[model samples]
Each structure stands twice: as structure tokens, then as C-alpha cells.
Target: MPRETPRSSRVGSRIQRVLGQVISADIRDSRLGLSTVTDVEVTKDLSAARVYISALGDREAAGQAVEVLNERAPYLRHRVAQAMSLRHTPSLRFMPDYSQADSDRIRSLLNSGPAGEADNKE
Candidate 1:
């Protein structure tokens, strides 16, 4: 049986949804071009949230995107608070989500390298 989702997790999901919309439509900064809100991880106490962002660019550009988001975190948090009725909105912290790039690299490596060549030697 699937475990019940905690309140913090539920809140985090809501935050992620709000952020996705807010970042896409509300904020129109050129530095954040093609950036997406990938995930939101809320602390157990729900005091703060780490928002993961996947940006369309190289590492430096991605880092700049994150910096731009972090700079506007207060506004983003307020946007989330407006969307949600939580008594206290968690502080938002923008972070670069590198999992996508890492997975792509791993996939390329696996595809380019031989698969278990030593295993066939018996």
C-alpha cells in the first residue's frame, strides 16, 4: 500500500505548481529564458523550500538563471502565498537542477561504451 503523503509534501507540490505558473507567465526576465520549475522540496517544518529549476542553456547560463530566480524569490514566494492559503508561506530558494544534464551524460556514456564486453570471455 502506498504511504500517505505528509502535509509538507503536499504543500511542496502546491508550491511547485504555483511557481511553475508564476515563473512562466508572471516573471518575464530575459535572464530566465526557457527556465522551468522542476521540483520543490519543503523542509519538514515547512519554513523554507528549495525550488529546483532546469534552465535551457550551458552551466554558466543556468547559474545566471538561478541567480535571477533567487533574486526574485521574495516575489515568487508572495505569488505562491497568494495562490495558496497557507498561514505562513515558506521562503523560496532557487537552485539549479542538474539531474537532467547528469542523466543525459550517463546515457551518452552507456550508449558510446561497450556493454559488458568482459562478461563474454567466461
Candidate 2:
């Protein structure tokens, strides 16, 4: 028999999906330029969640998007509750996911003349 998925993991995935749909289809804020829910981390008690958001625009715009999302978290929570049959919807705290930025920084460093000063010396 296969192992069962953890409850927290299930809730996190569901929250990620619901928030993505709500933001894309329901919210109409321009600051949210091409934003998507990258991931979600839900507490074991399922009382709260940290929703990671990613966007395709300037950092300022993405930051504004996170602010907007956080401000509308209650409404989003209601929407999620309506969509799911959970007794308690996780409280959403929107945060800007720095995954892309970090990856880009790493890539730039990697592409910047080999790897170390030793290589440039040779």
C-alpha cells in the first residue's frame, strides 16, 4: 500500500491552487501584473499559511502585488472556504517569493568569467 499524504501538505497544495485562481480570475489589480502563487506553507494546525507569490514584472510591482494580496486576504480566505469543504480555512499571508531573483543572481555569478579569481589569473 502507498503511504498517505500528510494533511498539511494537502492543505498547502489546495491553498496554492485556490489563491492562484482567485488572484488571476477575481482580483483586477494592475500591480499584480502576471502574478502567480508559487507555493504555500501551511501550519500543522492549519490555522495560517504563508503564500509565496511570483510575478513577471519589476520588483516594485511584485512587492505591491504582495501588499495588495495581503490586504485582501480575508476575502480570499472566504473564497477558499467556499471552494473547499474544510472546517477552517487557513489565514493567508502573501509574501513575495524570491526564488527567481535568487536564481538569477546565481546564474549571473556563474556566467561571470568562469568561477574564481584563480581562473582569471591563469
Candidate 3:
């Protein structure tokens, strides 16, 4: 049988959806361009949220994007609260999601073929 997700998880999912939309459409930070909200984890008490974000650009751009997001976190939180119908919206904490980068590296390793394959091809 499949395991059921907890109520907190459900609430966190909804909060993530609202936050993603609000941050993408409402938040205006030129420094942060073409950012994607990968995931959001809200605390059980709805006090804080870890917002995972991925950017489509170079390292410098990603760094700047994170800085901008951090600077505007308060505004983003307010926007989320406005968009969501929650009694206590969690505080937003922006974090660069490096899972995509890690996945890409793993894919590259797999695509490079087996280790010492050429050496073994005597």
C-alpha cells in the first residue's frame, strides 16, 4: 500500500503553489531572472518555509538572483500572504536548489560510459 502524506505536507504543498505563483508573477526583482521555484518545505507550525529555487543562467547570475531573492523575501512573504487564505503564512527563506546541478553531473558521469572502458578495450 502507498503511504499517505501527512496533513502538514498537504498544507505545505498548497503553500508552495501559492508562493510559486506569487513570486513568479508578483515579485519584481530584475537581479533575479528566469528563476524557478523547485520546492517548498513549510514547518509544522507554519512559522518558516524553505523555498528552493533554481535559476537558468551562469553561477554569477545565480548568486545575484539569490541575493535579490533574499533582499525581497519580506515582500514576497507579504505577497504570499495576500494570495493565500491562511491565518498564519510562514516566513520565506530563499535557498538555491542545487539538486538540478547534482543531477546534471550524475547524468554526465553516466553518459561518459563505464570507467576504464577504453582501457579495457585491448
lDDT against the true structure, each candidate: 0.84, 0.84, 0.76
lDDT of 3 by residue, 13-84 (tens): 876787678768877878788887887777767678878788776555666777888888888888778877
Clashing residue pairs in candidate 1 are none
lDDT digits (tens) for residues 8-59 of candidate 1: 8899888988888888888888888788888888887778888899887666
lDDT of 2: 0.84
lDDT of model 1, residue 16: 88
TM-scores for all predictions: 0.83, 0.83, 0.77
Candidate 2's error at 118, in angstroms? 14
Taking every candidate in turn, the Cα RMSD to the unseen true structure, in Å, is 4.9, 4.6, 4.1
Q: After superposition, how far is residue 84 of candidate 3 from its true place, in Å?
A: 1.6
lDDT of 2 by residue, 4-99 (tens): 239988988988888888888999987788888998888888888889887875577669889999999999999999999998888889889878
Candidates in descending TM-score order? 2, 1, 3
Candidate 2 residue pairs in clash (backbone atoms < 3 Å):
none
- Pitting candidate 1 against candidate 2, the one with the higher TM-score is 2
